[model samples]
Every structure is written in C-alpha cells, then in structure tokens.
Target: MELLELPLDEHLEAVEKAIGEWTEQQKRRCKSAQRTSSVEVAKSEEELRELQKQKLELLEAIKQAEVAREQQKRRIAANENETRDLQAEIMKAEPIITSLKSRENLHQGNLGNLNQESNKSAQAHAQVVDELMKGISLYQKLGLLIDKKRENNLAFIFTQLDPNNPNREFSFSLRIEDNPDVFLVENCVPEVSDVNELLDQLNKTGNISTFVRAMRLRFKNLV
Candidate 1:
C-alpha cells in the first residue's frame, strides 16, 4: 500500500538472479537434446556395422557359388568320357549278342527233337512191357491147370508156395478155373487122392495149357 521506492542495486541484483535461473533452465534443455542425439548416433553406428557384416556374408556366398559351378563343370566333363566308353562297349558286344542268339535257337531245336524221340521211345517201351506181362500171365494159368494132370509143374508151384506162412502149412491151386490166365489158390491141405481128379478138372476147365506150353517151349528153343 505505501509506494515506498526500492534501492536500484537491489533491483539490479534481482534481475541478475532471474537471468541466472533462465540460463540454468536452457542448460538443462540442451543436456536433454544432447543425450537424445548421442543415442541416435549410437543406433546409426550399430545399423552400419550390421549392414557391413551382411555384405561380407554375401561376398562369401558368391565365392562358394563360383566354386560349385566349377565342380559341376568338371563332373560333366568326366561323365562325357564315361558315356563315350560305354557306347564303344555296346558296339563291340553286338556280334557276341548275335552269336548267342543263334546258339540259343540251335539248342531250342535240339531240345524239341530230343523230346519227341524220348516220348516215342517211352510209348513203345510201355506197350512192350504190357504185352510181355500179359503173355507171362497166360502161360502161368495154363501151367497151373496141368496140376491135376499129375504133372511136374504142380510140384514146382507147390515148392514155390510161401515157406514162411504162419497161419497155414499148405497151399492149394486150381488152374484154368475160369479164364485161361486165371488161377485160384487157397491156403488148404489136399488129399493125395484128389490130385489126379484136380488135374482132370483143370484139363477140362483150361483145355489150352498142354498145346500152349508145347508151343512156348518150342518158341523158346528157337529163340
């Protein structure tokens, strides 16, 4: 309320204090800006280093690619030589293949001929065996029929009868009972009186034995 005048020195001193305070404030703002600039510079340096590393890697990869290309070219050259050698071998084998084919054809023809001959021989042999067995069987029946004739053939058949028989000590035979080649034999003992009668019955049943045996003996003598 009293308009009392202040001293000029005091007023000047207050102005100087205000100026110092403003200067301090500006210094703080400058320090903050400087810190922000330093951070930006560090980030830029890190980015540049990363880019340089990437560039070196790219250079190394390019060098490896060139080396791989050279290796591929060498492999191709070697394969070309191998292909040439294989082609030559194929050409040389042409004559051998032709000769082998001819030999195979000859072998096939020989095998076919051999198979035909073998089949014919086998059929002939089988026919001969059947005929021989049939002839032998017919003779056997005729001879047995003569047993009742008191012939020596009856004695021979008796001797040939099973010597190892366990259930029977004797065997009986009736020849020419039905067919000329058929004989009916049983395990039995015969009466000596029945022998002559049995031979008579055989002669009547198989009337062909005497003539057949005579002819067989004659034929065998000629052979």
Candidate 2:
C-alpha cells in the first residue's frame, strides 16, 4: 500500500480532471456578471426616460405662466390709461364750473336789485294817483261856488267856456299849462257893451280883480 504512491499515469490523470472543473466554474461566473450588468443598464435607461418626461411637463407649465403674466400686464396698463383720461377731463371742466358759479351769483344780485326798484316805482305811482284825486275834488267845489253866485238870467259857466265869445253872460275858466301848480284865470263879461274896449281895458290893467270891479260898477245887478 505505500508503494511510491500510485503510478505516474494515475497522478497525471487526477491533475487534469481538477483543472477542467476549475475552468468550467470560471466560465459560469463570467456569464452571471454579464447578465447583472445588462439589468443595471436597463434600470438606468428607464430613469433617464422619466427625467425627460418631467422636463417636458415643467417647460409647458413655465410657458403658460409666462403668457398669463403678459395678459395681466396688459390689463394693468389699460386701467392706468383710463385713470389718466378721467383725470384730464376733470382738469378741463374745473374752470367752466367756477365761471358758471360766479355768473349765477351775479344774476341773483341783479334780480334782488330789480325787485327793490319795482316796489319803489309802485309806491310812487300810488302817490301820484292820490294827488290827481285831490285836484279833481277841489275843481268840483270851485264849480259849485260859482254856480251859487250867478243870477237867474245871467249864468256863470266854469268848464268849456269860450273865451272868444264875449256875448256869454258871465264865463270863468281855470286853465293849467305846462306847470301843474300854476294856473291861468280867464273871465268874460257880456254887459260891457264894447268887447274891444273891455279887451283893451283888461290888457292895460293886467289885473283880473280890477276888471271885475269895473264891471260890477258899470252894471249893478250883473254877476
């Protein structure tokens, strides 16, 4: 049993079998490593695809946000323009409003003055009417007095007596010319035979009372 160990051929065959088993084990290991590497590459490719999709979605969102911002800016600008226009219109109207207020005040003052003047004129007209009434009353009284003094056949006329006709029995007239306070007194006597002589005497005397006295002396019963 201890003969130099097995024969030389038996030793060589054993060594060859061990070497073949080791080589087959190494080949299986290399194939497993290659499969693992392929799976990792596939996972990495899937992650890259997801990243690309997310980037596209983010780009779209950003674009929409930019468009909305532009629209908002335009609206703000339009509002600012409208506000400026309103302010300009108000500035233009300010002076006209002030002038209208001033004119209204002036018109009110003029109306007040006109009312006061109208009241004064009405009062003055009433006073003038009262004076005219008083004058008419006095004229009637004088007419009645002259009527009482006249004789039965010789009548004394006060109104509308003709100064040119000396044939009338007795005529007296009061006439007011341009002046309301001053009057002219005219009298005619028919008893005086000569009308021209009586006119001459009246002109010379220039006094109505003297002419009346002379007429009374000439005719005792004449009025």
Q: What is the C-alpha lDDT of each candidate?
A: 0.55, 0.56
lDDT tens readout by residue for model 2, 1-223: 6466666567877888777887788778878877887888888899889999999999999999999999999999999999899999989999999999999999999999978876665564444334433434453443312332321111234332234533333454433222222223445544345534654665565443444344444443343
| Candidate 1, 5-113: lDDT as tens digits | 4566677789999899999998998998899989999999999999999999999999999999999999999899989999999999999999999999999999999
Clashing pairs in 1: 148-199, 149-199
Error of 1 at 213 (Å): 11
TM-scores of all candidate predictions against the true structure = 0.51, 0.35
Q: For model 1, how many clashes?
A: 2
**True lDDT of residue 113, candidate 2:** 94
**Which portions of model 1 miss their true places by more than 4 Å?**
1-26, 142-223
